[model samples]
Target: MNMNKREKIYLIAIIVLLGLLLAKSFYLDEYKPVTEDEILFREYVEKVIDDKFHGFFSRSKLIGYRIVSIKKVEDEGVSVIEVKSENEGEYKNAEIDGKYVAKIRKYLFHVLPYGEDKILSRK
Candidate 1:
């Protein structure tokens, strides 16, 4: 191994600085963006489907809500967002005891540290 010209330019500048630090850590973990409590819990679940169907379905039906699973207990600070909306016929397993509030009439939307106020519960 005759690595000579300044040890092959310092081993090709340490293999191109370790391939640009593994492509900037996989492009900052796959282009991460979209957090502010996930855009305020997706605009508070589209105002909980426009205050649970007051707009009377002409369009924008929660844009077909589907978030199969999300979990963050964080020592019971709470965050368990599992959602699915088969066109807002909500297939049961419901529980929303405390926080997670969303209303449209007077514009109330809450998303913080989660633990139920109806965020799609079924199993």
Candidate 2:
């Protein structure tokens, strides 16, 4: 292999860039031991999401709606939890396979979902 100053710099830059990207991804997907609060929060979110699919003539028609992933973000002085959910069921004889993103406010006693549910897919 022939060594050149410019080639060495470029190679080093590429390696550093790749290392940074790998670190960022691992940080973003960091895993932590599940706590009681996390479990409770997930359950609460599930109930809230399932209720959204209810209709006037239907009584708890939604089933298998689950919190697929959760991410926490801080804005201003408040902590907002972003939840991604996968829902599957039959609503009024229509097959539903849906994905949703819900923003929730973290509170002392309970977490409340705010804003409209962002539908990622419904088909």
Candidate 3:
């Protein structure tokens, strides 16, 4: 069979597309935003903390919440918020972290001094 220029172009396009799909299975290139509920959860975490965050958590229930650390890792497309809660279940989110990671929702995450690490810092 004789192939024309158009036929060659079509064949190249198909091969390129297939190559992309295969590469995708092996690697991730981007991150999609968290859902609305995830955004709300982040805000809720803004509320949960301990005395280390007293300057802000003092007046509100956000106090006494200590987030020793947070490490952001990506899986598929969602962000896994790894937090060490000073107190058990201080920062609980049943729907989000319930399956992907265990013990992730146990601590207070907003322990940083509110309004600023020192003074004049932004929250």
Q: Pick the candidate with the highest TM-score.
A: 2
Of candidates 3 and 1, the better by lDDT: 1
Report the lDDT of model 2 for residue 36.
43
lDDT, candidate 3, 1-123, per-residue tens: 999999999999999986775454223321223565344334344444332345743456553332222323333343334233568755543334321211121212322222312110112
The Cα error of candidate 1 at residue 15, in Å, is 70
Candidate 1 Cα lDDT to native:
0.39
The numbered model that scores best in lDDT is 2
Worst 10 residues of 2 by lDDT: 105-114
Instruction: List per-prediction Cα lDDT, in the order shown.
Output: 0.39, 0.40, 0.38
Poorly placed runs, candidate 2 (over 4 Å): 29-123
Arranged by lDDT with the best first, the candidates are 2, 1, 3
In model 3, the clashing pairs are 49-64, 49-65, 50-64, 50-65, 51-64, 85-107
Model 2: per-residue Cα lDDT at residue 29: 28
Cα lDDT, model 3, residue 28: 34
Tens-place lDDT per residue, model 2, 4-121, is 9999999999999877755643453222326543543454455556566555323433222324354332222322233344545422111122232334322111122222333222
